[model samples]
Target: MDVDTRHWIGGRRVANADTFEDVSPLDGEVIAVVSRGGTAEVDAAVAAAKDAFVGWSRTSPAERAELLRRVAAGIEARIEDLAQVETRDNGSLLRSHRRGVMPRVAMNIRFFADHLSSLVHSDFDTRGHRNHVTWDPAGVTAIVTPWNAPLMLATWRIGPALAAGNTVVAKPPEWAPLTASLFADIAHEAGLPAGVFNVVQGLGNEAGAPLVAHPDVRRICFTGSVPTSIKVGESAARNVTPVSFELGGKSPLLVFDDADLDLAVDLAVEQFDNSGQVCLAAVRMLVQDGIYDEFRARFLERAATLVQGDSRDEGVDLGPLVSKSHFERVDGFVKRAVAGGAEVILGGGPNDELNVATGGFYYRPTVFEGVDRTMEITCQEVFGPVLTLQGFSTEDDGIAMANDTDYGLAATIVTGSQERAERVASAVRAGTVWVNCFFVRDLSAPFGGSGRSGIGREGGTWSFDFYCDVKNSVFAPKGWN
Candidate 1:
């Protein structure tokens, strides 16, 4: 398909004077020439959103829900096309994008639409005075989504922000902007009003900075790294604009002696599903002393079975990293880990043996043993197909080790005993804890992290709250009046 790589502003594709090549990581080929927008483009998008907010914020909930449903239908109809674009742009496996990510994008839109009615205002009486609480749209919201899982994360922010009657100025990562632009097309086809949704395509320093620092933007929602989020937060702080961050993670997966060994091993291997590019992946595995040896053997056996090849190839379990730089960064982590006294037990470098038409950015699924909690390998967010295994003596020791990191995005407890599961789940400092499962998400559940992982939450009512402002009104009694 011939894609018009341009910025989507005010319901139209706008071209910038300068452009950059959208390189496909799969084969290191230039896929498209994307417009390189800057502060001017961001200003235009924000102005458009502000102008549309007057009408959009006044629309009734039912009307907004209808438009969202239409958007969801449009996405569902073009899932295959979007999946292909995403696979090419982000280096994700075509099968995973088609069967996993694209469906969630559609589901996110529909889920927020169906749950709109639940964002209710409260009425109560306090000392014979009637009090009512209400919600209002928080002006123009600037949503900056990351390259990994581009469309899905974009929809995660857009669905709730739009459902709450807010206008949006979105900045999709420069590396993977095609699917996001396609999503804007789908929204326009679904009858989204001009400027209600706008996308500014450019590098973060040029376009994203202006959007976050814009005085007209009331809320800033960002999904990316911790260091970047700190800068975003500082920029928004100058204007006192509310900002929501879904940052990185060094999340842990704890396996107790009594756990379902097979299930634990399966989840441990599945951590490399998206080439370990997932923010919520279980990169740190903390196993109990009694079963650590056995678990390590089983996990290695499973990890060795992963098929690393071209994303478009069928039965390929792992795809290339997002870019050459990322591939190198992951490799550097492995080298450093080994130098730091960690043992590389399995595949630890790029896979060059795959038969492909052209050169691609590929890495083998790497596993490290004898990883201490304080080691850089165990503490840092590798953001690759690198897993670090550590052993713990007791349940308390396991929980302590799990919460030792600076990140608290997610964690999982695998065990047969419900009491043990609950105990560990409650003790872990992470935001979302999985019991006997991993990456099993529900739209209604609150998702986000504590401490350095992020601030605030996304999903369901929490999302609605973040995207809106609450105001309360009180009525006086007749005698008092």
Candidate 2:
């Protein structure tokens, strides 16, 4: 593990001529050096996938399903190892990865694999002709994952794409590429065919641009920031290749006066569990006037109890942000918000009490008040453990404030009244709405956003459709032609 991390291409470990340091944000140390794959590596991966596509696509559904099941089992067996690597590489709390992320990864793969048997074709009979509708693999697909949840998110694309019988060439974010290598190992152990799945680790501009723009790649699925996704889309557009995006969000968490205050406070504090680096984190809170003050008090009290330190610490609840650059970015956002008259009700900067020798990129969970809807901090994505509080007088006002952002990835409503919950959930313009909870997800449900959040969905049947192309065949009896 201490050696340089190489690319997993064409069913083997391939080393590049150049390498880059894989720094750990927790200790600000070079944990490992990873291959800096570029156009040549991307080309090799795509070519390998193309060469494997015909045979992989021709594999029976049962065979593919079995392979997927084996992969799932392999992931389960190596859950601890995968979780440790992810936590070390991404600066996520080890407990969070062990209990939350790793299990979800295995479940996501199995969920898609189990559904393969039910993937059926359709038939239609006319007066003189019989027509059939079938789903075919979209050849080779390029999957680009973000640094936040490398393995989990990549599996969101990889599981379904492989289940649909398409070969894959994946590019894990340069920041956290360790678990991706582990995932490739598990896939090979599960008896996946050579060239069916590949991983190229490097910077986005160097490796990602060429992969998306490659003429041989039929589809692209990317999870990252809005700007990066736009660039990915433009590249895919040139070749007329389809692309699916799960982009940024400034998600709102609505706390009605009638909501359970304790639960609201607990969930709000939970936002800092991953230091608020999640795309679906409830970064904005719209509380009713009656409960705004009390909610803010309880939220700050709870957030204060969270322990911030190195991700490897078992007692820590909030770990450092992913990298030094991300730490500076989050710090800058807080500074700007304060300058705009927003009050730092709880935390405003890094936690100095933690051992400095850790050298981690730590940021205390910050809570801000008096934030206006038009302010940059309110409308833009900070992608940090910073929450902006706004009070709403009416239900309409709350809904308006929630949908004010350009991004509509996800939102949550914490209300005791069933009618209010139903009404507000319908009114909010987000892809996923949690009625009484935050970050609750089901693999069967569609997950994506509207208006800059993302381009398409990535769960259950939606995933199946995105990874496959449909074809219609007709048969005429006698002289029907």
Candidate 3:
């Protein structure tokens, strides 16, 4: 695919001295040559954004919302093409992109656009004083997005920043950098002001570090793994910039003895979505002892039937890992787990059988049965199509086991009783909890993580709160109106 994978600054593509090949996970071939950004590129993008922030920050909420609406329209108008590219770029299911993700990307922007103008900013009287709260737009924001679900995640941060009237410089993951350039083109065509939205593509240390640590960057948003988040946090700390992170997860999926067996089994299988690359998927399952054997039997039967192949195939259920290195990392984790006394109940590893037939990083859906919280596989985020099973006896045991992990991003509870669902959902220390369901999201609800999983929330008013400065102006009550 011929794409302009260059740094976008001030509404134009900026050329670079160094370049990197963007490999397609679909077939392990070079799809595009992306311009590699360095500190210089980051500096240029930041300068552009800082210059644009003056006018953007001064714009009325209505005007910013209208522009965001246009950006949403532009994205939807070319949703098919966007989905196709994302599939080839990220090695995810095209059907999923066409049906769900791409639509949500546009909606992510549209929701913020429509709601920013109707925000609940009100003035109230207290002690003969009328006080009005204001959401003031921050200056330039640095957004570093991950390779998995790049477009969706980037827009999740970008939409709110733009709607809040903050100019942005996004450093997209070099592994899946194509669509970010495409997104920049759409924004420019939608008539977004120059430098309001910029894309700088390169290695983390070279480009990402400079962008996040830039003194002029007022806000930083990062979404990636735990180790990488530490680096980002350190860089942002130097500038004392406010940052928000959506990091790794070892989230738990709980099944009570009284849970509907069919529902529990189905939800357990859904964890393999995106080849278990999803951060929000609860891959570590803690099941009640009474129904443990039955759940395992049903889960194994369904998991074995999952067809792994190239993502371009229409009926294929699983796709390759995002890259060669990621596949090795996941495979190594499985091997180590098996050696450490965890029994592989199902798939152990791919023997390169699928990759032999087709070129790419392919692994079978794997499950380990004899898993314990003491094991690294149970505690660490493998970020693969690997599930670890551990049986718990009582409700307290299940909750304790679920909360054992250092990460608290998301969790799932599958149960028959409403009381149990409500109780467990409340007790679980996660940013988002689903009862008898998975991946069902409402845009208005607050979405973020706790502990090592992340720092702040970014949905609806939570997003505005992150990208804006909340202030109150006091006035004389009688003369204010």
The numbered model that scores best in lDDT is 3
Compute the lDDT of residue 218 as modeled in candidate 2: 97
Cα error, candidate 1, residue 135 (Å): 1.4
Residue 188's lDDT in candidate 2: 94
Query: How much is 73 displaced in model 2, in angstroms?
Result: 0.8
Candidate 3, superposed: residue stretches over 4 Å from native: 477-481
The residue-by-residue lDDT of candidate 2 on 1-481, one tens digit each, is: 4423899999999998888888888888888989999999999999999999989999988899999999999999988898888888999889878888999999878888898887776678898688887778999999999999999999989999999999999999989999988889999989999999999999999999999999999999999999998899999999999999999999999999999998898777776658898999888988999998899888887788887887888988888889989989999999998899999988898876652768888888898988897788998899999998889999999999999989999998999999999999999999999988888888889999998999988787888889999778888877744
| TM-score (C-alpha, index-matched) for candidate 3 | 0.98
- What is the C-alpha local distance difference test score of each model? 0.90, 0.89, 0.91
Question: What global local distance difference test value does model 3 have?
Answer: 0.91
| lDDT per residue as tens, model 3, 1-481 | 4568888998898998899888888889988888999989998999999999999999888889888999999999989888899899989999999999999999999999998866777789889888999999889999999998999999999999999989999998888988888899889989999989999999998899888889999999999988888888898889889999999899999999999989998999999999999999999999999999999899899888888887878898899999999999999999999999999998889738878877888888999988787898998889989999889999999999999989999999989899998899999999999999999998889999988999999888999999999899998746533
lDDT of 1: 0.90
Candidate 2 Cα deviation (angstroms), residue 322: 0.8
Q: What's the CA error at residue 333 for candidate 1, in Å?
A: 0.9
